[model samples]
Target: MDFETSDKVKLLQEQIERFMVKYVYPAEAVAKQEIEASGDPHHEPKVMLDIRAKTRELGLWNLFLPDPEHGAGLTNLEYSPLCEIMGRSPLGARAFNCNAPDTGNMEIMAEFGTPEQKEKWLQPLLDGEIRSCFSMTEPEVSGADPTGLQTRAVRDGDEWVINGHKWFTSGAIGARFAIVMVVTDPDAAPHQRASQIIVPTDTPGFNLIRAISVMGSTHGGGHCEIRYDDCRVPVENLLGPEHGGFMIAQARLGPGRIHHCMRAIGMAERAFEIMCRYANTRVAFGGPIGEKQFVQEWIATSRMEIDQARLLTLYTAWKMDIYGKQVARQEISMIKVVVPNMLMNVLDRAIQCLGSLGISDDTPVAAMWREGRSLRIADGPDEVHKMVIARRELKRFA
Candidate 1:
């Protein structure tokens, strides 16, 4: 893989770096204040709207979509480094309309939606005029196993009726639309018995129960508990083929996991910066904390891990460019396990170094720490990725 950045990618990285410093970082507090005052996590903040406008004006919109006509059309390798810069500020990705759940939903529509679907949904999403979510995990079942899903979508001539309960359906509470995965052929083979359907939020019987908070934050945009109580939509809303939902989910998640790793590396970088800044200025034992051997060790090790994770992410991106996502599964799974664990370590050290301030909202450390914890389970739990890695290894030996 070529290690040198193309001039185009270098320009993108520089632009994103400046945007994050000049705009996103300053807006972070304002966003929080808006969310708090509204007491509605799902409400889009005015500051976010302003940021979105600026991002769109800068031509940074829809950078994740690989299709040139629909988005920036950059290769995965080209997009990886730019995403990392956006990752530095957790909210910056969305400001550029590249945030997850939405990005995954957009990719699904781009790849599978009929032209009409694209015209009504995909275009608005690309334009940043609306948002979306994916609902697949069921609270009552072991969601790690897709075959264990209990949600059902049944056909009725011109319409399909969906009935199920889903929680941790990330980004549902305020999204204008959702791509739902449901069992359409329970009697069929386990893996091939499900399907994906696009459901509008205003459809009858579709309900958002509440935002399910994890580790104390409401995750603005809302990871929610949802119920489709006989919610019905036209047959035209089905995405991909009947009983083909699993493959589509996998395709969406492969890129999703890599994006998480890219952002996790960014989060770790931010934490290290915060750690170093605090270490140098804060005095303890009659000297700067940076003078302490243990603090210095933490800083040095953080640099090592963050750099290593970034290279792994880049390599995965390069492989995807050359061999496609299927051939690069091992590399994707490897970073899925490594990056989150590494970030956990880095964030823990940062929290310790910052003393009480890290645990508090005074710095962004508290929020960063929460996000690192979530990465362990979000896309696929670490255990699931490890299992995939082990199976691939055994195949090698065979």
Candidate 2:
């Protein structure tokens, strides 16, 4: 893969970086205050609206999708750097209408949704007029093993009735609809048992328990806990083919991991910068902490690790474009384990370098630390991914 960034993506990278500095950075605290004042942690702060408008005006919107009609028409390799810039701030993705769960949902809908389904749910989402969620992980099942999913969706005349318990339904609290993975055929093959159904949040018996707090903060459309107690949507609400939910879910993860890993790298890059600055300026004894051997080592190691993870991430994206996502599964799993752990390693060094200030929210490091911890578990846990990587490698030798 060419190391040189194309003129087009280079321009996008520069614009997104500028957007991050001029808008997302300033809006972080403003958004927090607005949400606090509104008494709704998930409230869409007004500053976000301004950010969105500005991104749209600059023609920097829906960048995650490769669809020329709806998105920036960039391949995974082309989009990687742009995604990294957007990953620097928590608000960056949303500013460009390319946030998670929503991005994944949009991808599947664009590929699978029928014309009527696209007209009703997909367009509004593409336009940023509505948000959506994925309801797949369950409180009762081991999320890492999705084939064991217990949620049931029964055909009831013209409607499908859903019933199950779900937690960590990311972005469910304020979403317009959810793409729910449910068992429509218990007797079918493990991978073919579940189907994805679209359930509007307002549908009867769609019970939203609450947004589960993460590290004592429930901001944005929080990771929600919800239940479908006979919740019903029209039969036409099914997404993709029947018994194809498992395949669709796997399809989304490969590209989504590229976004997640690159974004984590962006956070690590910011934290590394913050740590180096503090090391150089914060004095102890007779000199800057950066002059100390331990601090020097921390900075050196962080730089090496960040660059290594980034190259691996970019390589994975390139492979996904050159080969198909399925062909690049090993690299995908490898990065899924490598990048998040690299992020945590960098964050830990930065935090230790900052001492008390790092543990506190004074710098973005601690928040990034808290948030980055989940990356090891989200998508697929480090253990599961490592196992997959190892198994794939072992099969070649055997």
Give candidate 2 misplaced runs (Cα > 4 Å): none
Model 1, residue 183: what's the lDDT?
96
- Which digits, one per residue and each the tens of the lDDT, describe model 2 over residues 75-110? 999988888888888888899998998999998898
lDDT of 1: 0.90
Clashes of each: 0, 0
Q: Can you list the residue pairs that collide in candidate 1?
A: none
Query: Would you list the C-alpha lDDT of every candidate in the order shown?
Result: 0.90, 0.91
Q: RMSD, each candidate, Å?
A: 1.0, 0.9
